[model samples]
Target: MFVWHGRLYVVRQVLNSWSERVPWWRSTVQPDPPVGAVPERGDHRVWRVEASPGRALGTATYDLACVPPPPLAGHLRPTWTLIRVAD
Candidate 1:
């Protein structure tokens, strides 16, 4: 489920998903690893999902992303972010 612009939407189907690696070389802040901990490799995952607002509202495709936890925090859950809404 996701909310946008004061309206709530439910994910109907996931069309696709893919992982993206963060370009560490391009970043100013280098990732620091905790003692005995392996660094996290991926940055974010993009998901193409079909969502429906409601019976009154039609369905639409949306691009969403899941941001992975920090390198030192392997047990933490990933956070979801909206990327774009397709017409």
Candidate 2:
């Protein structure tokens, strides 16, 4: 569930989804570790979902991402973000 432009939108279906590896070596984003933790597996998982704002004509597609915590870091939780919306 989410709100876009003051209208509430509920995710009705997930059309597609995938994961993208985070190139930490090529970017300034540093992986959190205790100095000897194994390298992270990859980056966030992306999801393409179809949502509706209570109307059939108001249906739209949106992209969401969920970033998992680093390896061995059980104290942290995955973070979700709304990446984009298709018109």
Candidate 3:
């Protein structure tokens, strides 16, 4: 999720395909007592994305990834290569 004006905004595509990965260190050995949190290994995150198809000209669908987070209250930019239209 990207923070804009301190508000969180998630990508549509990623939200649609939202996922998460838990830590594996805990499973490999004893849990760390310092942190005191049983690491649920392989626990994936859930995404709640909101995408606007055809928000712009020549844009049909926008593929959201984990790189280059959304701008903070500046502008909602879409990845040129990742943006696509459903066939």
Least accurate 10 contiguous residues by lDDT in model 2: 31-40
Error of 1 at 8 (Å): 1.3
What is candidate 2's CA lDDT for residue 83? Answer: 84
Stretches of candidate 1 exceeding 4 Å from the true structure? 22-42
What is the TM-score of candidate 2? 0.64
Determine the C-alpha RMSD for candidate 1 after optimal superposition of all C-alphas: 5.3
Q: Look at candidate 3 and tell me the lDDT of residue 44.
A: 40
- Cα RMSD to native, each candidate? 5.3, 5.2, 12.5
Backbone clash pairs for candidate 2 read none
What lDDT score is found at residue 50 in candidate 1?
Answer: 93
The digit string of per-residue lDDT tens for model 1 on 1-87 reads 988888889998999999877676745477576775445455789999999989677889998988877766768777777888996
The model with the greatest TM-score is: 1
Cα-lDDT of candidate 1: 0.81
Count clashing residue pairs per candidate.
Answer: 0, 0, 4
Off by over 4 Å in 2: 4-7, 23-26, 29-42
Top lDDT model: 1
Candidate order, TM-score descending:
1, 2, 3
